[model samples]
Target: MKKMRERTRLIIQLAFAALTNGYVSGFLGQKLYKGKLKQFCLPGLNCYSCPGALGSCPIGALQAVAGDRSFSFSFYVMGCLVMLGALIGRLVCGFLCPFGLVQDLMYKIPVPKVLRKIPGDRYLRFLKYIILVLMVLVLPDRVTNIIGQGDPWFCKWICPSGTLLGGVPQVLSTPALQASLGFLFSWKMGILILVLALSSVNYRPFCKYLCPLGAIYGLCNPVSLYHLEVDKEKCTRCGACSRACGMGVDVPKAPNSPECIRCGKCASVCPHDALQFRFVHRKKEKHGQAENIEN
Candidate 1:
């Protein structure tokens, strides 16, 4: 069952990568056969300016609205985030996000060193919130007067993913754009290099400490219907689950911890089969079956 779940996760991840990078990013280059289904933008860090993107990115959209002097909807971006939080929660970080896949692939490259400890200072995790405010909200608004409205501040200045997928490609493909390179291009390239270097040693430095989208999704994990559950009656409490958890979550104790990305690593490593990933009634049924067997 564990192996099966791993295989399924691998398939999903591969499909996500293909869709985001291969299909969506490369869609325009192909024949204009059909358009994408209409949906409110997802609350993630995907680049809206990327050629293949079918929908607007939340960060890009947020910056655009925040920078705009004329109109800004309080509900659009927040509502989209709330909806996604209520649905899949932090599963987006583990399964669906293309950037998460990039980080995962980077960690697999047999690097010299990798982050083993989860860090003693829990307060450091709050840095993402500060970044969300400064980069996404405050900085954009402050710079709007100087830089002009409709600028995607985060995308243009800081996002490594945007630099990788949109800026670099667009510049390389269009010689005219390359000629327009200035200090902004150099700064973005520097940010991308820093992120790339950090990703080699850190498990998911971006998701853990930088992604505002992950911060939002993580807040809902404790209450989401789709969450991890631990059967305490069956649990041996050997701490294997916690040790195995890559996201620094105490999985057996706090199965639906906000820090959990729902990568299934804890459930996959549990020796007693005490940890499970079932909905409410499914958990009840399993517990009842165990009772019946024991009786």
Candidate 2:
């Protein structure tokens, strides 16, 4: 049953990845679609500049709006992110993000993996929030050139997804892009290579320490509509759930930790079936019913 559930999730992840990058014609022809769908942002981290990508990336869109001279804030991008986060939190990261899928696949490679946490791992998790605030938001919004325009710092400097899906593909396809490549492109490529190398050893180092999109969704995890519920009555304190968790969540104590991606591994591995993926408001509904009956 656990295997079945995990297989289902894997299928969903693959489907989302394929669907978001389904422009096979563009991919084959080495062209990008400048279509209406590109106006809207995807729930996960997919690069809009990718030859096959059909929709815009939320983080990229947010940065674009922030850096735009005409716009001070991106109501559309922020609203979409907030709505999705409120609905499912980091479930999007688990099931929809193409980059997350890539990282997961990288970890599956048969190698001597480093499964243990390093020193200050807990403190390092906060780095994503700092990246989100400074690179994703502040720099793009505040730092401008002589013409009052700023660059998408995160996309330009940090996003390995863009380097993998957009920059690499575009450069390979266009000889002109290769000729124009300079220090910045080389730096981004170096970062991508480093991330790929680290991902083979560590499980989702980017998600844990650098993904600004994950940081945003993580902030909503505590109050998200969908979350993991721990049944204290059935819990035996065996710590199986925690052991099964890939994201290092202490299930019994912090089942709803912002780091949890709602991957359901904890619930699937629980021998007592003490953990559940459920709507947060369902408990409120039950409480309201009990109060009405008492009245």
Candidate 3:
């Protein structure tokens, strides 16, 4: 049953990745689609400038609107983000993101994996929020060139996904693009290489530490409709769920923590059937009852 569930997830991931970048002719002919559909944003971390990409990336679109001096804010982009976050939270990272799929595949490369946490791992996870706030939002909105134009700082300076899925393909397909490549491209390539290397050893180093989109979605995990619940009455605290968790969550303590991606790995591994995926309209009545009694 577990294997079947995992296979289904892989199929879904592959299908979504293909659908998002379905312009196969673009890869063959070295062209990009500049149609009306490009105006819309994809929910995942796909690059808008990817050769085969049919829609704009949400982060890229958000940065574009934020960086535009004429526009003070982007209600449409903000609304989309909030709605998606509230609806699915970081399940998008687990099941939908093309980059997350890539990282998951990399981790399966049969290498002697580093199965231990990095030093300061807990604190380092907060870096993505910092990146989202400063690089994605603040700098882009507040700082601009002399001409009142600001760049997508995250896309330009960071975002290995863009470099991998967009820049590399474009540069490979177009001879003219090769000569125009400069230090920025080299820097982005380096970052991509580092991320790819670390992903092979660690489980989702980029998702855990650097993905701004993940950071945004993670904030909504606790209150999102799709959530994980732990049944304390059934739980034996054997720690199987924690051992199965690649994200290092304390499953019994905080089943639906902000860092949780709602991947269902904990629920799958729980022998006692303590963990479950469910919609909780409010705090569990049992927890409230316990708190009242304790008080």
Question: Which order, best to worst by lDDT?
Answer: 2, 3, 1
TM-score of 2: 0.94
Q: How big is the positional error of residue 223 in model 1, measured in Å on the Cα after superposition?
A: 1.3
Worst 10 residues of 3 by lDDT: 286-295
TM-score for each candidate, following the candidate numbering:
0.83, 0.94, 0.93
lDDT of 3 by residue, 179-281 (tens): 8999999999999999988889888899999999998889988778887777776788899989888888898887777778777888888888877787654
- Please list the residue runs of candidate 1 whose C-alpha ends up more than 4 Å from where it truly belongs after superposition: 1-4, 20-39, 118-121, 146-150, 281-295
lDDT, residue 55, candidate 2: 98
- List model 2 lDDT by residue over 237-263, tens digit each: 899999888889888888778899888
- Pitting candidate 1 against candidate 2, the one with the higher lDDT is 2
lDDT of each: 0.70, 0.87, 0.85
Measured with C-alpha atoms, the lDDT of residue 143 in candidate 2 is: 96
Q: Count the backbone clashes (under 3 Å) in each candidate.
A: 2, 0, 0
Query: Which residue pairs collide, candidate 1?
Result: 24-52, 25-52
